[model samples]
Target: MSFRRVIIGLLCLAGLAVVLDFGAAAYSEYRVSRLLRDGSDLGADPEVTFHGFPFVAQALDGQFRDIDIRARAVRPDIPGEILVEAGLIGVHAPLGDLVDGNVRKVPVDEVHALMRIEPVELGRLFKIPDLQVFGPPADKSDGSGGSGGTGVTTSGPIILTGTVSLTSDTNPVPGTSDSGKPVSVLADLRLDADGQIQIVATDIYYGDEATPAAMVPEVNRELVLAKFTRTIDTRDLPFGVRPMKVEASGGQIVVEGVGKNVTIDLDRLQQP
Candidate 1:
């Protein structure tokens, strides 16, 4: 056989090997996605992406460096839909066990995740059906939103009513006899000791986003702030994502979490 022919055969074999590796990785990703969706009770299959090529090597070695996942509607049993973007780091799962469909426990060195909290969650927690979170006031001098001008932190917007009215009605404005007093939620999102989102509204400006008005009545000041100032329970989440930082982004609240040296027990993904 010619030397060139031998070289060509070797090249073909290498190409086939690469194709097979990708196929295997794709299959594994599909299987893991299904498990995550059903086990976590997510609305649909979570997007799973394995890091690095030659995934077969990682599987044979039984250690995965990183795996990214984006899941919509996680923890359906919990109030409000939860969206999740997570990364699994240093996972340990043998290929044989996984192939046999007997794989159960998936231990990871760390799991970093971002949980996007939609308006519905805040509405239920804040007792406002139409709660709106917005970016800092366009005019910094207006003080409609909070970012301290540096723009690192953010706050939610409040169209106040209910006890906020104080005059009579206890429902959100527009429903109250008086028109809805537009209040921007200048709240600082913090995680309480219990891992709950503790929103402390530092102040509220009564006006639309474009226009900034005087602060509400001092007596009504604390009253209006009180409606948004409270620790909300969100401990019940899929994949055991623990809250780290809660911030307002693009008119929404997103809480980032990280779990270190975590073990995923597929049987009790929810544990509820």
Candidate 2:
């Protein structure tokens, strides 16, 4: 009987400790979130989470295995609202400083940030008020409309459909009703050696990507598809990380990068 009672007591204590640890972790997240939001251009409070079990042990050691922070509408004066997601590995934050309510400096071993732009936002930036991105159709698809054919893969060249204005009247694009007409462009998104995201169009269709789409003449293609091609600078990437790769996924443009042995101060945290 005494043995069972002792075992029950120890189990209760363990459960209580787990509860307290979670509570402490939540409080820690709140503190870090507040600090991240302060002295920065973060339009909203960052969603912070720590990975690995035994949060209390990691907290006491002042080292976290991995941590993630997410925020929306980061920075101001950009073309549109952007979502930023940052993942830090081997994060070092002294427990004393954290408890003292003033974490002077957080040195992270590795950092990766993802900047996502929705299709609508991309359209706004490119001056195409109605832009859409979709994966290329499978072998069975005819590539008439954006996602018009089924069996779309998650990766690879995306079809961009929008109204583009043709400046060069050198040669007329087929089925053009106005200077600005609905067009579908099959473009490949690739990272250039010069640190730029280049959208190179392979084929362009007139009168929307519908049944029996009309292909633009190659001679006048440059004039009609000029706006469809673009070179984007990687300087505006979050956390000052070099733009590593870009892809169109789930109807959004995602630019991801990684940094090593980085320090996160208040100022550094604010601008991203």
Identify the runs in model 2 with alpha carbons over 4 angstroms from their true place.
Answer: 75-78, 99-101, 137-156, 165-181, 205-220, 270-272
Clashing pairs in 2: 144-209
Predicted candidate 1 versus true structure: per-residue lDDT over 1-272, tens digit per residue: 69999999999999999999999988888887787667766667778888987798999899889988887773433366667677888989896675455777788899887777776766666666666665554555656553433223454432222223345345334222255544554666666778787767777655345233334555566666777676666564446776767777644567777889989765444434
Give me candidate 2's TM-score against the actual structure.
Answer: 0.79
User: Considering summed lDDT, which 10 consecutive residues are worst modelled in model 2?
Assistant: 205-214
In the order shown, the candidates' Cα RMSDs to the true structure are 5.0, 4.6
Candidate 2 lDDT, 1-272, residue by residue in tens: 99999999999999999898888888877777766776456666788887877898998888999988887754443476788778989988876576454765678899897887777777877777777776664344555434533234344566777766555546645524343456677788888887677877777743332223345667757665666777766554556677787877777778888889988664455354
The global Cα lDDT (0 to 1) of model 2 is 0.70
Error of 2 at 27 (Å): 0.9
lDDT of each: 0.65, 0.70
lDDT of 1 at 71: 77
Instruction: Give per-candidate clash totals.
Output: 4, 1
